[model samples]
Target: MNNFVKTTVLGGLIFLTPIVLVVAIVGKGFSLVHGLAKPALQVLSVETVLGAATIHIVSVVLLVLLCFLAGLYSRTAGAGRLGNWLEKRLLEKIPTYPLLKAKLRSALQPEQLETLQPIMVRFDDSWQFALLVEQVKPDASLVFLPGAPDAWSGSVCIVSGDRVEPLDVSVQRIIQLMKRLGEGAAPDLSQLRFGAHEA
Candidate 1:
């Protein structure tokens, strides 16, 4: 009974942490942008035209414009060098920053998602679905074992290539399966081996 409660609570945390972090980050950014734009709105007396709602509308517009400008700037060669410098010198120092960056990139960039190959990893008597992150060596593969309920909280492992079977499935499909807590995965689950490992 205690183990079940602990497991359930942990699963809930895993599912909520990403959502909470995203909401908190966006809220903080909006607050900062709104604070900066508030004085300007008051100076221009825009409140007289739109009344109380003007501040929010103006803040949102400014935030969107700022995001557009930043995206444009990041496309330049200098931005690439600056980004690398910041990551190596400052951003990488923060423990969660790298993981956050990778997750964000994977979410926003389709090409990054394409690179993550779906596969089945032999784990004792059962098979676990994972993403083939990279080929660490000729016989060793780096894989991401996604956690159920929240795929982002997965763990990375370097396993033997022989134990990893590449699947004819998409990364998005695998993520959806994880998000659904492996429901409707009977066809895939049927492939799990018993007793002995396969070559």
Candidate 2:
């Protein structure tokens, strides 16, 4: 193939790939729903009055309930550990999981302040907003300092132990500030002492 033709074909394939995948996935989901709903319709005999629409609607609702039940179970102590183990062994292998992992973690653990401990970490001369992911050691900690307009992703930096200053702020509030590209309201970090270094 000529250079122009090759480039055009590659561009077309790139555009069509996701569209085709979406269509295929949607079609398969509909087929599965139809199959499952058919049995429920026959058992309930709701199809006689409400028609086929009832089956599809009920199926979707039931599916949502099932997902909720699963999520509730995941929030438990034992099941959560199992799920985490399985995810680490299997799901983590997927490249996309690491990308969306942070987003999902926030959604799943809304009340867990420790999920992303909002902190005001000091650099050599200045203090920048950061999230404390975890403590590698008593002194060493993993921090994620996000960029504005898209705090969903960021650089993982391990700052000096003394430079890391804890902040009395919410992760959601910081995320909001970041989403606006720091053009709006800022988190109240006045409570956090940025005084002389102390262990």
Q: Which candidate's lDDT is highest?
A: 1
lDDT of 2 by residue, 14-87 (tens): 44554565567666766776788788678876645666678777767766676678889977999988989989
CA lDDT of 185 in candidate 2?
47
Lowest-scoring 10 consecutive residues by lDDT in candidate 1? 190-199
Each prediction's whole-model lDDT (CA) = 0.81, 0.73
Q: How many Å off is the CA of 33 in candidate 1?
A: 2.6
Q: After superposition, how far is residue 173 of candidate 1 from its true place, in Å?
A: 0.7
TM-score, cand. 2 vs. native: 0.66
Give candidate 1's error at residue 122 in angstroms: 1.0
Listed per candidate, the RMSD to the true structure in angstroms reads 3.0, 7.2
